[model samples]
Target: MAFADACNWINGNVNSNLTNRNSIQAICYSDVKSQFGLTANHVVRACARVAANRLTAKRKRRKVREFKPTSFDCDARTFRIIEEGYLVSLSTTEKRIKVPMRVSNYHIGKLQGRPSTSAQVCKHRDGNFYIHIQLKSDAPKLKKSKNVIGVDFGRRDIAVTSTGNSWSGKDISSIRDKYFRTRTSLQKKASQGTRSTRRRAREILKRLSGGEKRYQSWLNHNISSSIIREAIATDSIVAVEDLTGIRERTNQKPRNKTERRRSNSWAFYQLRAFLEYKGIKEGVKVIAIPPSYTSQTCQKCLHIGTRNNKSFKCENCGNNCDADYNGAKMIELWGCSVNQPRGSELLSCDINSRATESLHLPYRKCR
Candidate 1:
């Protein structure tokens, strides 16, 4: 925008020397108007953009810098600079974000990723300042292998992969149960009496719920990260179940009628979304197959209908395996076989492609 005009110079000049918030620099607003005769506002905007870009690049794990027009051979010689559309302030060094928020510059110079025509920004609830830059490009993903991984979706356990790997859905389940119990108890107490103490209890419960939501957000991040990491280690395509029609297919106990409305809630959708993005980043392909009979099939012999007890033994194959692993394997097979729709029990939005919506994951909603 108007502020983006001076970025060309700022890209080279933005450093510890330029940012003297207390002590004005030689090239302040007056200098921009007098020296280059540029918009006084534009100079600062460009400077901030440059600063933000520098900081963001420094922080990046791969350190991919914005695509400088001068650095590449392209048919397009230059990109237009956007006004106060989007901008940020980044650390001159140390790869840190020194600014909590900044304006946006739509103009084009050099950018690190996919370029956008609109403004973008990111804010942190964590107290740390961040230079928000929306990289239009996504992190590159690794190639997916043909190998199928069995995944078991459990109620008590979060998820157990066919390869004997497991991660706690503990955090997720705890949040779900904790929220249910505390919220229910508080409401009951309030209903029993309209005392001030009950009112305070209700407020406390509300805060507790916020905490629970935050925990779940973090939990989903952890689970997705773990799943992607595991997939990377094995170099196999993660096979998940086609969860389509899972709701009508199974019975789940809820706390009460109201809470049942959020039955699927945030956990399941978060896991899948995280996995999808992670898969793209890591270059792993995720596959979905029919979820039917995955739990009943024996991993050892691929025998079906052998589950007679909690500790499953293949009736036809004589294979003894952990019931969890068997379930995960079934999910993997279903993931590899076909695409399924999400179950009716899932209340959250399914962000997956039409094909992946019902694909089962190794994780279970520990509700």
Candidate 2:
């Protein structure tokens, strides 16, 4: 009720008339507090939050929509963490309620004996309540490394590293296929005549989707951790492809239905994000470079190559190599070239130049 009132106030006054939070508060505070039985502080916080959101959306050239039905924001001052991080006291319209939280040691470590700035209380589609807390911490100083490791991300092999190691996507692909098969069966049942059968099928479908998401998240965490560990062991900076606008690009290409579905469902960005934050915590540099021709360009000769399935055959040098491994090497070379003293000269050097020849020496072996 308080959230709806705040959204109403913002839509009616602040967004429409460009009025300030103070003016809006003066106009609606008393009425909102009286009608919703909310404290004065809650009303003020809600107004301020809505106004701030409006300002941010305007700056970003985005349209600000009203709050959804399932979530609400709570100011840090209005909530208290007590009982050794096991309980949270939240303020509501009638009275304060203490909610028990099942927190892990990982979360406790992240808190680091400091209170969170604020929290969002949300109800998931599966009918579960969750609290997301935001905290502030200083990042550790990055460690300097003399080596660079390039990572090639793909659907067949989840990640291929310059160190001649790869994480396979077989398990992830199999799980996705299994989910699709199960959902297809459920859909047939859902189209039956009985209402109860349809309702049951829908519930099962929702649960299956949630389970698939959790499993994928686990796989990504393990893969990212292994990649970071390899970089730390070698004291190397991690280089990856900047896959921005990849979905749009993929959508533009011609593909069959199954291939298109697989392309759209892959979680490349999530894995990248995991690598980035984990890299930061481990004091390793993770950089993203434009993936213009990382796969098509030969890592050994820098010549254009034709890829047949997983094999890459260099047109000029006749060098045969694994396509993903070759891409990883090119990414690594690019990383090294950009970090050198004469970076631009190295970057724009001809494929037959002495500098390019020397750069190929380190990563010439085929995996």
Q: TM-scores of all models?
A: 0.54, 0.76
Q: CA shift at 295, candidate 1, in angstroms?
A: 0.5
RMSD of each: 16.8, 7.2
Error of 1 at 115 (Å): 6.5
lDDT of 1 by residue, 154-176 (tens): 55566688778877565566667
**What global local distance difference test value does model 1 have?**
0.55
Q: Which candidate is the best by TM-score?
A: 2
